[model samples]
Target: MNRLFAATGFVPKKDIRGIILNRWGHAFVTPQPGFFFDTATRTAPRNTVMKGYGRISFGHAELEGFQHWGPAADQGRRAMTQALKNG
Candidate 1:
């Protein structure tokens, strides 16, 4: 799986596990917990992390409501900046 991505010049992290090997000899894996809404909901504890990361909902609405979605081609810039600063 990692080998295939590497062959195509896509370098994936090595320490990641729980990957699913498919029939096409491709590997699919979920992102690390807390990185996205779905995974974060499953992994984050109650009272520790706000529901939907304090957004009204997930997806486009949430992104727009939280100002995470930027105008035109600059989408995610604000969110990415916030993430980097917070990190």
Candidate 2:
């Protein structure tokens, strides 16, 4: 499932990809990534300890589905991966 894709703003015409979790305990299944969508996740809330941080994959996430761009985004993902391997 394209969990990362769903994190971005991808309104599916049929089916959504998956769920996305933020720094908080909140879960999102639609477009919730971007600065306008979520800036709070960048900072901590209340008295929480910042013990660890995970650097997400360094690249832009693409929204794939019938509504956003179409299911062909899956093919592009595979092609990109293959190109990376070949190089």
Candidate 3:
């Protein structure tokens, strides 16, 4: 499932200022920690306090399924930075 989602080229884009959150993501913090705080949640939303906050992890290193500090993650961060800067 992790590989399948990663292959879809999907990156959370709802973040207004790059804030990310996960209700219950077990995939995070281990085999796929990259998505720990962005997507791939293991539970449903229960708190309303986080409402209005941006949920996108635009250029997060591991959010894209790449291992932290990996070359691919670096490239993704760079790309997201550039995109944000250009706009």
Candidate 4:
């Protein structure tokens, strides 16, 4: 399953900012619902509470493997930095 997803580009080819893999081998595109809500309540204005809040839905279970061993956090950070530098 994981191989299929990777072959089809269903999962992220690599990790990026704000993305993380869960224990179930699924990619969490955004923070969990509760955590997002809590953070929004504390730091975001009411109007913007839903601004950056969203869900992580995937079309393939194979890609879900990313939730377990996707790229490391620092790797994601470096990728973001490199993207910014190149752009």
Candidate 5:
């Protein structure tokens, strides 16, 4: 499966893991146990990580029970920043 995707020149080789291989030979990482409900708005609430629609993955410890996209993006950004800072 990975070989096939690599040969097709679909997704970059470095990202071909821990996700489902889709029909387009692309990696499809399932949402991290979250959901979305669109209010027809383009942007989600500030500090809320929104995947799509109303799906959210909250970031702050105070809002841990909520789902949001801000938290997810913020988390990734924080990790990258920390890694760079460390190096």
Candidate 6:
């Protein structure tokens, strides 16, 4: 799926792996390394990497998680930032 399909209320496994396929027609069923949740908002059904989106995967409460679009992008950027800092 496109990054546009990711947002809050999205559980990484269900949202990112169910149907939305990549350009190569590949849907991932596995989580990346360091995939974890904040201890504060552990009140979700599954591994809730998205927390501020609607059923339509829009950023209704995106900033609530310090995330811009969704978990996919947010995590990607976070990792990039960490890598840059380390480099």
Task: For each candidate in the order shown, give its overall lDDT on alpha carbons.
Answer: 0.39, 0.38, 0.42, 0.39, 0.43, 0.42
Which pairs clash inside model 2? 9-31
**Clashes within 3 Å, all models in order:** 0, 1, 2, 5, 15, 4
Residue runs of model 4 more than 4 Å from their true location after superposition: 1-22, 27-71
Q: Report the C-alpha displacement of residue 80, candidate 5, in angstroms.
A: 0.7
Cα lDDT tens digits, model 4, 10-72, are: 555453335555654433444343432336336423223323223311132122223332434
Candidate 1: what lDDT?
Answer: 0.39
lDDT of 6 at 32: 38
The positional error of residue 54 in candidate 6, measured at the CA in angstroms, is 36
Worst 10 residues of 1 by lDDT: 56-65
Model 1 / residue 63 / CA error / Å: 3.4
lDDT per residue (tens digit) for residues 1-87 in model 1: 566667676556655555785654323223344433445335433222323353322222222223232431243454455455555
Candidate number with the higher lDDT (1 or 2): 1
For model 1, the superposed segments whose C-alpha errors exceed 4 Å read 1-62, 65-73
TM-score of each: 0.21, 0.21, 0.22, 0.22, 0.25, 0.27
TM-score of 1: 0.21
Candidate 3 vs candidate 5: which has greater lDDT? 5
Off by over 4 Å in 6: 1-27, 30-69
Best by lDDT: 5
Error of 3 at 60 (Å): 14
What residue runs in model 3 are displaced by over 4 Å at the alpha carbon? 1-69
Q: Candidate 3, residues 1-87: lDDT per residue as tens digits?
A: 335565676454532346567665323323333323434554322122112134322343333445455844674666566566555
List pairs with backbone clashes in candidate 1: none
After aligning candidate 6 to the native by TM-score, how far in Å is the CA of 58 from where it should be? 24
lDDT of 2 by residue, 1-87 (tens): 345566776557546566586664333224333422225555322112112123211111232313232444553465456456554
Give the Cα error of residue 32 in candidate 5, in Å.
18
